[model samples]
Target: MSLGTLGRYELIREIARSNDIVYEAWDPQLDRRVALKELRLPDGISDKDKHARKERFKREARAAGRLEHPNIVSIYEVGEENGRSYIVMEYLEGETLRQRMDREGKITPEDAVKIFDQVLDGLAFAHENGVVHRDIKPENIQLLPDGRVVITDFGIARLQFEPSITVDGQIFGTPSYMSPEQVVGRDVDPRTDVWSCGVVLYEMLSGQKPFTGDTVVTISHRILHAEPAEIDGVPWAIAHVVRKAISKDPDDRYSSAKELKAALNDALQGALTDSMGPPSPWGPPLDPYSAQSPYTYGTSQPPGTGAPSPPPPPGGYAPTGASPYGQPYGASFPPNMPMPPFPPGWVNPPKRPLLSPEASEFLLRTLIVVLIGGVLLATAVGTIAWLDRRSQEATAAKVDQALADEIAKVERLIPSDPLAAQQQLTELRRRAQSHATRERIERLLSRAYLERARRLLDAGTTDETLRQAAGLAQRAAEMAGEDGQATLDAGKLLYDIATRTTDPQDRFDRLTEASKALEVAFNSEGQVRSEAGTLLGNTCLQIALLFGDNKARSSLYLNRGIYYAEQVGNRKLADDLRSRL
Candidate 1:
């Protein structure tokens, strides 16, 4: 079908194309994209088949449109143009999990858990609204740059939506991830999605599909009767969760995504506690000195020693500057108590040596002579020392000022032209380093390198960019103290690499490094709480996304994001992400 325009949306790109129709299109007018599906009538095909296909498109669009979760990709307007069917949807920028896995092998446990949680959160939302995602697989999941997980192609399985598309008894969905009931064409429920999620998780963790065979017939048989190989090297809790999720009998598996999520959460909590130890205790300790009394003076006894005083004032009369009961000048006594002796070293000043008049006259004469001579010597030496110090200070100050100015310029240019900023920073570093300002120059240079690394990442290809970014970040981290912003930025850069990279092992290592850096940042006390929290959330998200079935880890990412946002006063962003859940 040719859609000249769908509302305000101008067709920008063709997304999905098949022999029967152009399945998806990008729309610009409504700022929303749509799927344009053509209905092709072949010779000998009955009119009933044509009507059924159209009806199926409408049904699927309607069902999927009702879903309202951040992670569930939404379908907007549905209509027909030029005898073809179409449905509009929100535009997405990320590749499918299938593409990612295909490119990078298995996902890390962190990435798996994060992506799985997003899928499950979307599925759970759908199930609560009485909708089931029959085809839940990696291809239907998208990982957005803003760290969002989007589940797509909902309610669009060909057989389920259109009876005429396939025979009733024929199986649908990606064979390896399909549940037994789905393969056998039995009535299914939300557990079907849970089972599919399990398969996806297993594939993510193991880098291989749970059930595989050379023939469809054998694969179907395996789905019906075979047990998947034990998921070795994965967290035991996660393996257990996947096993239950993919159980042959629907009753043996989690009843819903919510149940599966709970189990995952438990596992994540256990893992975090086991790995990080318990949280610190709250509030301050009791003071030990608040109750102590002041020491007495004339009596010569400490207040807390409980020693008896020698006696009261000799005449029972107050001395000069003493109160009526013989308290020291301006002293306030506790009610019902007689004043004690003033403590030693309290009221009286220390005595000084007495000089004879004649000796004092001679000393003054000698002091005047010595002072004049000493002044002359001191002035000469002080002048030279001051000049030398001033020269060094001026040089140091000039280097510092130049470095600071260059750093500011580079920082301002980073978001616009990272390469230019990097070059400029390198020049500034060279200038500073020539002046023997290694520490200061290295820091600025490292920051510039980090910016370049980030830009490289945006340009594409994870490996080279990630490695470069990580190297620069680590250099910055090592040069700067643990709690310094440079170190934190380094950790965050490494984390971005881990999260964006497709390689499971690389992702794991990157995340591990990032986590350690974040820990250092948290412990630094000088680190911004909000930045630390955000990095922690990002780290957890990567970990969970890699792990697959651990919903708790994913939730922790969400929670940490919220916490850090609150700490940093960016609660709106946190709320937006959490709203998807």
Candidate 2:
């Protein structure tokens, strides 16, 4: 059904959503179509919830608007007409990855890898910009006719340094794709997206989902406690890489999307041999199961699939049918260069014989005799290598035991003697040899520092005490390693301590530090977002007032403060900040 016009755009049709409506609109200025998502709440929702939802929708627009990439959906503008809020974005005419999977089950490993490579590339860019896509699944992936893959739906994205829209203890994400931390109501970061990407990869390489159940609760349980079944008929190295990406512990997973992509590429290089040809680039003609030459949306489907293909869009553009890697379609291949699979039935002719049969046989016999001598000598060397390996293993075992004992001892001290725990953890961190051990130590230290800071802030409000607590809290935030509970707690403590200071210079310096810490906390899931935004806005305003001589700098601070106040729906604060202008 046609909805009313929103601004200059005419809404043509409404796309389906449970609690919202997205209209397919035509933009007269751009002379093209666009998608306009209206932030309308369903009936029966409380006024408080409706307000929160509107704020969240605005946040989605702001978060997505900051990103500019070929593989990411582009936001054109965000506006409100009367009381209705709407977001305008580039209209995409394509099928979702979920639709493609339903049409054709289980993509080839090589093609799946290509798709994953692009997904990770987009994710890497988003992470670099400090946005975390909390919900990533096949449904959120759109495949264009021109072989371009786009990630859609930033509705649940968390922007770094902005107070999170989601409330504490609220679980929001596709159940099957949710990371363990997410399933258990813990804070998320780039690693959370990495886990979801791994789930998508697993589904693409295999016909089945990594985690599935009849109910959301059941699915969440599996996500938290169960391991995915092994992917069969895929390269062992590639499988191993995916497994690591989906580890139960965030620390065990790839630290970032870039790291995961690198691991996947390395695994692919090791799994494929030269003779079998390089893996395909991200595009069409890679589908071997399709009758259609280039498998695309609205094209011919595989036989006996029963589902009918949708018609192509009007004035649909043809596939580029070219590699994105700066090469022509049929260029002479360079050695070790990864390329798409050759067209069906194409084969390379055998090379001409280098020598006569008798000559080759005689040369082979001579090589065998040399190889035998080499093997005898290698055996003697291997024995010595084996002894050294045994000795190293024994030493590693002892170090591991000692490290465990130290960790346990520090854990006991964190509650009553956090200062001592922090000191010991710092020392232990230096001696930690394993990645897991270092991660554990860092987490413990953040907690210890946070506890100590909290206690100090609770005990007194003296200038000296405030400074001491601020220092400890700052250290705790640094050690928390991004979007942890300790980081959020430390940020609040730092801000509280800074506000208690009476001296202007002291307050300015302390608030500056608190702002940095709170920026990170703002992007985490919690009920403190509104509180953080208020404090941040106030801090910026205070700083501006202290240095009112520089009009340009003051104006900048005032505008930023206003933006934050408005973001948290504090219209009074926003107006107050604006009155200064």
Candidate 3:
């Protein structure tokens, strides 16, 4: 059977081919280069298995499509036509971390921290949204040319969907990086990401994986019980963090990606600061960025062993005036030749004085006095400068404290009176002048409005109150600047407005605003796409559930909802909605 094209997408060069699927194609119509994965059905595979595989493929595509993060590869479309299944994903240009490690041996500690941070950030976002990335290994992580790190291959990721497929004791991850629990076929959580990250860190620093054996079972056993070798001679702080991350027990590891990221940041900071100091022979070797070339001033070697040959004496022979000890004759002699010393205290000649003794004494005293005065003046000036800086810091701190206090007060008042709280927040906004101060104030105000709006909607308050809340949320979104939290809060408020209303025109208008707000939130720096996707899907579902006639439109919304929900691993909700169909 001939496979028809998907929309305006055109098949491009095949970038990658695997046993299970072939990835190719780009969509110029959408201004995106996509990877089209066409699964190969093996001979003798039953129709039941084929249908399951197709559903699974579609589910994976939808789930991956919902995740919008710089560190996660995106899926654009998943469809089937004429017995062929296809999934379109973002075309990324970069070598896999596995390939990089193989080529570069070991990554520098600084680069390791940076790369791990990106991984953690992505994982943290996914974990928070209830998505569990079951398979995380070096091969799945792409290192982009611009130094960005992205995790790929969520084909076997766990999402919130029904009839959760269980391989029944089959291991899912690479043996080298798999957590002990994963190896034992036990349930896992965000900490699994932490454990895998530790393995990557260990490999990056040590130029070797933490665990290895002749067989997969041996490796699995080592992962379960063995302690990794001491990472001496490597960067210390990084080694420490990596050790904790790769702890055999999940409880011994970082509880979340955020915690791991913080640890990595601390390690990086310590490494940088330690590198700025004088080198110590007992400590780890200094980074290249530190003072002095390691090649020139490093630890001294033992006598006569591998020492550079002493430069040949000036003309390959000792100089005539040279002493037996290699010192030049007369080198220690005074510049001016002096007569042989006479008897002690013997007077030779008299010289005329330029000034009177009393005058000279007075001038010396004045010079000494002036030097003392200069020292005192310098000390006073330095003290004044330090005091001024301290004063400024104190003032900034006070302003920050005041703003925080007011924000807390407003937050506490949100559930009681949203408009009154908003009015108070507006006053706080007027008082904040500096960009930093205004940004903080606006974030708090946005959160307040969002919480109040959600609460009011849940309480079944007047539609007018909801409208006001939405307006407040929009205002907050405009003022939020780059804070992802504020943008998300505003989007949520707008979404609440859209869902709580029954009027078709009003609901449509609110949803349009909600979509725009969510789009803004999704595009904002540091914002995760999982939450936004869920909200978007829910909005679409609400529209269909409250207005649409046939099951077709509702099913479409449901399908999209399941896709996004699964992408982020909101399985319970996704399963429930899928069951409704």
Candidate 4:
């Protein structure tokens, strides 16, 4: 059935539906086929909210469209019509890697590396050009019949030159594939994409996510703390490389996609030979999973399960012929190429089944009766559902208003009654929109804790109080999560605690923490940019002072302190640091 037309494009049949609908379309203007994608916003969202989201989406999509990489899907154009926004992209004739993974189960090591190598090359190019693809997964990667691997979806990629469109402290990503820093809402550079690549590569080898849980919270905690299980059917050499690529600490992993690709090539050399041939067009089919499989969703189902029976979020019964990628299987046409026409007479859909006259008559009567009953029942149900929905919405609105008021109050109170504000924010989480608002609330709470602790220190607190205050400040910094203001506040608190601590070990630890936090503040236009630099430099000086007779080490800190102080026109501090030198 025809969906409708947008601009010069005619959206014909819908191939899939999820958070968005992917439609096979004909671009009459270009005389070519395209895939038209449209977004699906949540119900009850405000027009302003919808508009803002669409605008950002258009901007990002347009930017991604400009990318000229062969392996990236080329968005031919983006447009809005009838209050709906869509992108017309070069359509491919293959299936997603997700479908292949489900169909083939785990892939051969050689095929995995082939796909990984191409992906890494494309990503290396993208990163060099300042694009960081934040969302990379089996679902977003596609495979072609000609043995080409293509990366799709730049929906969440950060164009480094552009300011972030997301709100401060608001997190956006698929939970299972998220990097460790991404999970904690920390500052993400291109290294984040490397971590996600490791995850995709692992899934390609093992047919399972290394880190997963029943809920987002559980999964996030695991990504942050747990080591991935060893991949079966692979040598320790391959596993070792995978483990390093997915290291929880970004500092420990390869610095770039190019670096990762080189390492993968080295690992593949010892264990794999050229005889492996091209990868299977698809992976293992879905069936009753073994007791050993980590993923349990739809595992007990027979092969060729039809559309799945309804289940709770992230769990459901697999239906016949559904692709394991959580959507109907089809290749997203490769980027940078015009799509060939669909097979001749593709418009001919499957015919409807026929019924005998007697059976049709009996079915018609039964359907009429059921239709009458269904209408009556629907009326009653609709009334009940409407009332229930209205009541829930009202309650949610009231709670949201209350939460907003609390946020406002906390912002006001944080300057003076911060301890109370911190307590209030902690309590407000009970009413706050759980994952939707949790990050923002956490950052606010971080500021509250930092403020209260700093006030205590400023008022001449005891040694125990200083220690307690420093701990609070540290938690605050963690919760600040790349927000400039919150980081600066927490950084200042850490610096204060570091300066006052007397013990040898405690001072070193506090100074280390202080230096880290203050560096972030110095990088941003934090309320204490110069102050953060001075404190960070001073922390370094304190560490150097411990070296005692090590003049070279002490001189490094003294020089750094003088440079920072001079940066802000603080001659007095610079001179003092120079004296130390």
Candidate 5:
């Protein structure tokens, strides 16, 4: 049977179907061929829920579509009807990494390195665009006939710059390559993608996966506790990259994808011959199914060797979503995170219903108790519940306030004692009581990093150091999110890095990130707004000049920047911005 049309595309045939259906379709509007992905959804959902999901799907699709990189598949459109949603994207002639692995077993180290580099380049670009492919597995990575790799399927991709909150304890991604934090249900960031990439690297280099078990429980246990099996003949630099990328603690991993790729390049170029050492390891070696790592919060292992010294206390980190708790259904508390304030011998809280709907109704219907008795009982119950809620709120407020105070201390120390502030913030994060608190702490810590990056850029003369500073600023920007003061500061720092860097493409990418950050900061006043406007305008001018592909789009940015400069009463900057326009 012929597949029907979805929106304006004629679905020629069903290409594939799993959780979603893919149809090779013709886009009449564009006179082009496109792959249509149809995601199935259950009926009977609330309209609100359905609408929210569709919006999220479209937003993610739009974000992915905006990315223009050689190794990324292009997205065109998204639509939803009835209970199904569809996305139109560029159709490619190639196989997935899973198919390649199945046919060839494992890849050669040389080919693997090249493939890894290409993937990282795409990922680095995506990260720059504030996009994170939460799921980066072999099956999701497509390979072209010419040996070019394209990162596809941004279904679960999240915008890194958007503030995300967790309402339902939910997490996503495949189990086999899940990072340790992912296994335990901790909040994830781009570094989580770094961990998954390490798993891919290991699998490509060695025919077998790093961790395995008979069941999801066992697999999760291994992922949390087991060290990756060593691959013989791995040069020190390659080994170093692998080790650092897969580090159990996110803190131990490279700060950014650019840094990870830099490590790979340094190893490939023999720059690491004089300085190849251990990094964060699969927390001390354990039996593959042991379910526990040797290192604990008290351990003092070397950096990257195992869980390092706990960093400073928590700050203003917060993320909100229905994002899964980083763990699977049966998984337990993740390693490295601070345990809740349970009593020494506390077991699981007893599951008991406080008040079922039936009881309330029965009470209402009971006659004699209805008058004075019902009134008294209802008042008592309501008062008790209110007191309990107020008490809980008060306690949480105190904890959050304390965390805020600690973060303020870190901020004070950033300019004068960055390392100490960093160390202190790291420790505080471990102590942070909730996911939102941890996210806030991460953002505050990134600011401390920004402060250090500024100093390094000011003082350093080495390309490596400059890159490192850029990486730090990126971490700050990614964690602090896409708006307000931190992002603006990060934009300025990235702008500085761009001016200093000589590589044309890298310079362009950095400038692009800078402009994005500055645009978000355009609403502010004083030097920041003026600086952001001028920088954004200049950056846009450079992108348009160098790329020359989308002058119209570039003109949009140039105009906005000029307007921002004019708003700030900076006539000189406004005039300069107009030159770009």
Candidate 6:
């Protein structure tokens, strides 16, 4: 059926959805096609709610119209016709990220990082301009055929200057990607969008959502209490960044989208610098500055491949039509020019040669000499560079050996007086000349820090002492630097300190850190894996106790505790915890 026109736009056909029909429409004023979304209220909506929905519909236009970033969808106009609100936007030729994910299952880690980087860029700009995209999901992110990603649907975005239309305790957004605070109807900030970005990145790389449940209630519970399983087949740096971005506590997450983007950039430093390999099978070449046209342009050549081909000749083809002269041949001359008569016995002139044979032979001889000279020069330079590199490596190795010896001496002090050992290792780390030496120093430093923190905790449980111990323990975890045994000891120390904290929030934060470190330790076949598992189980129980009112979350944690307990061969402890269930 023909839907007729709204304002200047002629509705061509319904694109998708009902109730709020998005149509492929034509704009007569600009002679361009656009996407028109009409505001259609549900049949049973209240009058006040209807008015609010209308305002919200128009607000999408207002929100997006203010931003002009390349990754943001362009809004043309918002208007009302016959008491119906409609928005006109540039029609993009591409599928949503959701559709792409459904077809491809998952994106390559490299390409996923690229897409994630762009999404964060767009979100960072939106956040800087005081807009929080509360409902960031794959369905709302558009991936153009040119590999250009655009964020759409700002209908639920919270603008800083505007009064929020949301009723208290009302929740908005997809359950799987909502932040812990967002799932519970708490006040949200830029970090809420950061959480969603993390979920999107995880899904893109892992082919699954980090949090999943059959119902919204169950999903929300998981979001609030459950730790996401580590993503497989990705670099530890990348996985670590993802884990931090999706922390259950907003305060523990990156402060803003910009910060998250920076962290991801660091994690992706090498991948971004290396060749992006083949062009993405998901899209065409990325052409952010191409002119708008109904017809798509460019081949599937990857970005940075080379310049585009030149346009066709003036009339769309080279002058291959009838010639002005008698002979049948292509002509560059204009068709309007009169033909001149040729003199009798006239012959076509021979083409002039650029150089005589004698001159060409001389040029070739000189070129041969220059080529030989160039090769000799390159070889000489390379030999010198190789020798210099060798010398530098030798010097570095000697320095590394000296640093390692110093670290060995400090290792003895760690067992007896860790504070003094930490001071020495910290000083030695500054002069460490290689990655291995630095890593060794860090591992020893972690032990020293953990031992010192343990001593402080034993002295007393005052707030000052607890704070000091927690700080030291956190440093230990950080300095452990991927060493499973060191990380386990630091984690166990942190868990011990966390359980003694008086403040519930403080306890929760510390426990989260302790569990994160322990999780990393437990994954490795380290000496303390069993101890790490037992403490991890206990930490889960503590978190469950904190969520006493929410039985779903509590029960979820209880089950996790029992599972971890069994993994460590503590069947009695597992049974005891299971009885609580």
TM-score of each candidate?
0.44, 0.48, 0.46, 0.48, 0.46, 0.47
Clashes of each: 36, 1, 3, 17, 39, 0
Q: Per-residue alpha-carbon lDDT of model 6 for 449-568, expressed as tens digits?
A: 888888898899998899899999989988997788888888888888888998987897788778878877877874577887788788888878886786765676688788778888
Clashes of 5: 39
lDDT (Cα, 0-100) at 119 in candidate 2 = 85
**lDDT by residue for model 1 (1-581), tens:** 11223433433335665534443454433423455544445665677877766665676676678787898877777777656566666777778898999999988776787777778898888887777778888878988889899987753443233233445666657788788888767666788989999999989889998889997756766777656676657655667787788887788889989899888777666655664333322112212222332422344444435543345555753434545576454344444555542221121121121344576567557767888899998999999999988888788777677677656767788677866876786677666633445565566666667777777777886577777777766666665554457767877888777767788878866776676666556555434656776666556555556646656545544565565556656666667547634
Candidate 4: stretches off by over 4 Å: 273-581
Q: Against the true structure, candidate 5 has what lDDT? A: 0.72
How would you encode candidate 2's per-residue C-alpha lDDT over 1-581 as one tens digit per residue? Answer: 11336887766667767556888886756667799989878877898899889988988897789999988899999998878899999898889999999999998877777887888889999999999999999998989888888898888888998887778978878888998888768889999999999999999998899999998867875676556677878876778788888888787789999999899888788667642344434322333323442333455654335434344457753545556676543334444445554432221222223345676567558757888889998998999999987887677657766889879988999999998898899999998766567778888998898899889878988888888887888788778776545556776777677778888778866666666666665566545677767766887787678656867556766887897788778899989999997
Residue pairs of candidate 6 with colliding backbone atoms = none
Query: What is model 2's C-alpha RMSD?
Result: 24.3
Which whole-number lDDT from 0 to 100 does residue 166 have in model 5?
A: 32
lDDT of 3 by residue, 101-186 (tens): 99999888888888888988888888877777877889889999998899988776766544566667766777898888888788
Q: After superposition, how far is residue 203 of candidate 1 from its true place, in Å?
A: 0.2
Model 2 stretches astray by more than 4 angstroms? 274-581
Q: What's the candidate order when arranged by decreasing lDDT?
A: 6, 2, 4, 5, 3, 1
Please, what is the whole-model Cα lDDT of each candidate in the order they appear? 0.66, 0.78, 0.70, 0.74, 0.72, 0.78
Q: What's the distance in Å from true for residue 468, model 2?
A: 70
Where is model 2 poorest over a 10-residue stretch in terms of lDDT? 343-352
- Give the C-alpha miss distance for residue 559 in model 1, angstroms: 43
In model 3, which regions exceed 4 Å deviation? Answer: 1-8, 160-163, 275-581
